[model samples]
Target: MTLFTELRRRKVFRVAAAYAVMAWLLLQVADILLDNFGAPEWVFKSFTVLLVLGFLPAVILAWVFDLTPGGLQRTPDAAPAETGVTADSGMAGREQLTNRVILVGALLIIVVMATERIWFAGRGNALDLPAAAPAAGLAEPDGPPAAADPARSIAVLAFEDLSPEGDQAYFAEGISEELLNLLARSEGFRVAARTSSFKFKGSDADIGEIGQALNVETVLEGSVRKAGDQVRITAQLIEVDSGFHIWSDTYDRRLENIFSVQDEIASAIVRALQLELDVGVETAGRTENVAAYDLYLRGRQLGREPSRAGLLRAIEHFEEALTLDPRFAAAYSGIAEAWVWLEDYGGVPSTEAYPKAEQAARRAIALDPQSAEAHAAMAFVRQRYYNDAVGAARSFERTLELNPNYVTAYNNYGDVLRDMGNLERMIEVHRKAVELDPLSVFMRTRLASKYIDVIRFDAARELLDEVLAEYPDNDYAKEELANLAVAQGRLADAIPEYRLVHFSRPGDPFSAAMIAIVATRLDDRALAGAWIEAARQQGENNRWELLARRPLVERDGDWAAMAELGRVTPGPEGALLRGTAAARAGDWLEARRLLLEALQLDGYDATQPARLSHMRTLTELAWVEQQLGLEDWEDRAAVVEAVVEELRRQGAGSIDENGVSPDYVMARLAAMRGDRAGTLAGLQAVWDARFLSHWFLATDPVLTPWREDPEFIALAEQVRAHAASERAKLAGLEVLP
Candidate 1:
């Protein structure tokens, strides 16, 4: 028989095709990585697919011609009955087949090696640095403002593991993290991020290199040595710019005293940094029970999300910690937080969980007299469970006073302030959070979007752009970017970003909903339909019960689905879901009635209350209000505008609005009403926000009407100049992204 016929009989073609397909998959993966890491648009998925196709010819050649060994081992004529070969002969034939296989493998390896070496090498050099340098005023290691202040800039090095048993790595890491958190919580200090500082844990990076890398004025390093009940820790605070030891200490304590470790470390670090921390010695006493504290730590490590399973596990740990030391205030608070978290995450009823959260929080304070976590927990309960804004604010304030650098302090405080119409302070607080957690992609995104909330798209865009550049993989950024693009009428640019978001988080109903929205605009009915169906498949996702919330098409739908999830199925979020379903099902009045009923619960109800200020809820509420708009049309419209504006400003990241942002929506609405001035205002906001992509700004359809406006050009230039100035400030930075 012909070799081709023999190969067909042996199914060699199918085998070669399988290998080719695998090669193709690997090639696609490489392309995806490159794209995600900032590769050029010229890079195509089909490019990798074609690379696999290249192997097809070689594979087919092996099948078509019997030139390679092991090419046709399964010939039909070689059947055992027909060949009549003895066992010895069969063994000899197998040896020959093995030799053939080895030859084929060797050749294939060489081909793959050559292909990878040549094709992958040039792909890494995709980014093009601009010829013009960053503007003249860019700050670097040589002279950070913090360097001059000495009090604000700081770096935290890895703490030494004190445990002689050598299995306390998690403990040691937590200690360092807590110290970092303590410092981060303070408004008086500029603590480095976990990623930036932790990058040097076992590295040879000295104080000088670390200072330069972190761009800080002071560096803190310490070592821990613990044996059984006894522990010893030595720490030194060094001034990076001057290479001087600013403060030093060696501490010895019993393992049982680790309860006080968190507060003690915070005080020491503050003194070392020379900051005027209002918090002092008594604050350290707040960590009353070491055992309870340990339990809390163990609980934190148990679950990925705040689900009931994780919360239950966390509750056990927190309880144990408290049991080891009943006076442990934070442990009691931890138990409270865990229970409250479980209400939303574990799917328990608010009646069951909210009261528990409140009780636990109260117990913590009773036990410790002064617990930051306890205060925060109480605030959550009051806000979510009791609906007492005033009380919640008081507790939130207490938490901050106790620990100014608390990350959540700023977030929760800002949220409350916003509800009170204190937008300016809210922005300021979030700004502090962003500074403290510069490498926190999540915080930055929130900060940027908050800027948009006050109709300050310019600032929001700048922040969002920075977030996208540094953490392009963030679905939040991508969604906002897509929305911004669509707002600008740049459907082409907006589509890919939206699609990317849905693709990255296939099970995220919000993303799928956005994808559907964008697809509808782009006339991709099929894609839109497919995405909507997929969105329907993703269960409920939201957790909070709030009066106002970020505008979202899928929150009611998707989050309700999440409510049905085994964890958060029957809690406060579930109630919101039932309410949302009533609204979406065209029973607008019923929806309003249900939501109002849910709102009657306390602020401490926890989950949805925290995120209630979202524009989506406000917009829907406005619609419901409109259905009964006899008494307050102007007031209602104003409320709607505020909600819309707030949604527009969120996540802008210190820059102005872009195409996909809601600014375009307002601008268009104004234009349709012959509000030329308003249109111009929106257009100006978009241009001022340089955080968006050139592709998005250029392509979105929302801003199409504004394309000819003279103000647009001036605004764009101004934004670009501002961006240039900012980039110049980070010219020689390390890990601040």
Candidate 2:
């Protein structure tokens, strides 16, 4: 008589239940498949919307129709006839069987859905998984583990700040980071670095998901409640696979005993993991003054924000911490780290910031000789500011030895390897850095750039595209994409990307300068002139301005202007370019002196934007050496032989470690050696690679002897034609506003 009874009699409830289970199952499978296949989010949303819309229709159809023993039939408004008839018994039996089947099917669907969720939770998006470990020697035993070891590998998530005001977040993070550092220093276990672990700070993802994402077996998480001078810290070490607590403890301590509490927590965690602490490894905090430590923690929290005001504020906090306890080595290290970022984020010149960073790093190291942060800071300064690769390498080695979980050290060390021209080693270290911090977009993009350096364009593009999909407006990734375009001779394509970058950062000298350079390559004089002026105004005579101007000078065959640009370019790249121009102007002795100066100032690999390859410098020097009949010509020739063999080993037309087209370098080397067959082979390879730099090809002194050759002239014409085609495309494109 009731509506509910009527619905039940028609089996609408059963149909609804079955439909719900089926819909849920479909959604689960769809989500997993779509995510794995890199489907657009809207596709999944539309699928869900369609399934929801179909639910009511399915129930309505069930209410209206029913399956009898012989065929489909309309459901009766009243209950089935209860009279003593054979048909009634058959109907009851059939109804019971249908109910049982529907119940069992729903259970199975639920089980299947749950299992899929569990499986996919353990394995995240399939496409995002990191590649396999590189060659054996690539990952050092001391670095973060490449694979999870249940007994040792762990991630220390950022601690929750449960203070009344919820303002002790920095204090809580400091405590968690201290535990992470202490665990990292202990032998026989792997600790995920802070960058990866803290990524799940406020995440709703469960333990298993975090573990799989971080590639760890266990996770350490806790909460901190601070009330004035007293603090209550609760810590628990959980087995990520099982979500079981391996060790848990609560500490109630005064502010002065915070260091002791950290040590106690570290000891308990180490004991629970059955690992012994290594002697001589650095312990918890470097200072006993809690006030100073609080300031240091605040400084560190702000330093993570990569902006000028935040970094400057971070420095102030660090300085205040130092004033509280002048002997706090960690605070000094924090200052050094802040200074390292000031050049990029705070717009401080490297000439001004690096010296201050070195001073702070030296002070930190002096106070605490075992300070890994101090060593890493010193290493970065040595690499970037002094161009002392050997010194930088030594410091980075010491840093990793002290704290092998240092992701930044690995990344910078990778750069050092790049500058040292050890392509394999550079790639290996970059892989290690990514292994340690899988969630870091910075690390991923840097590795992509390294792949670009070696002409691994597809791999680089894949990584960049993956990053862009997740972070659509990531300028760093976009910049690397532009770099890839340039490397592949897609100069016209690069201009739009550079325009996007410039739009994002309107006054960025590097992006503006890059736009100018690409515009010059495309022979768009109007675009080139506009961006060049923009770059000079914004660059304030920085290295980017120098690099951007060189292309214009080369386009005009102004060797004097090139030499003048080089005189003020500042780094080894300046000396190298100046030497090349000097050689072009018939001053072989001056060229030799400047070329040797370049060799003394920096390693063989050239920095980007300069577009001065080590091979270019070597070829120029070779010419100069022969022209002057220098005594070191034989040694130079031997070096040239080794370089030539190295280039050949990289495969023809590859981009070498310095981001130079190996084809271009090889062609220059062959021409310098006066081997006509090698020269032709190299030129053909260059043409195959489409390295159509018309100005460089036309005016390159190394290619002067080949100018009269028929094949060389043909290749030159091909380059000019390609350039003209690209120029037309550029002319048609709307200029950037």
Backbone clashes counted, model 1: 111
Q: Write the per-residue lDDT of candidate 2 for residues 495-523, one digit (tens) a residue.
A: 88888877775445677778888777777
lDDT of each: 0.56, 0.75
Q: Which stretches of candidate 1 lie over 4 Å from their true place?
A: 1-153, 162-166, 177-200, 208-216, 227-230, 249-254, 257-291, 301-316, 335-359, 381-394, 416-424, 451-737
Give per-model TM-scores: 0.52, 0.74
The regions of model 2 sitting more than 4 angstroms off are: 1-150, 278-281, 344-347, 503-508, 532-539, 603-614, 631-634, 647-659, 730-737
Per residue, candidate 1 scores C-alpha lDDT tens digits across 76-156 of 355534323234676557646855665566577677668744643321111111111122221221221121233577777
Sequence-dependent TM-score of model 2: 0.74
Residue 460 in model 2: lDDT: 94
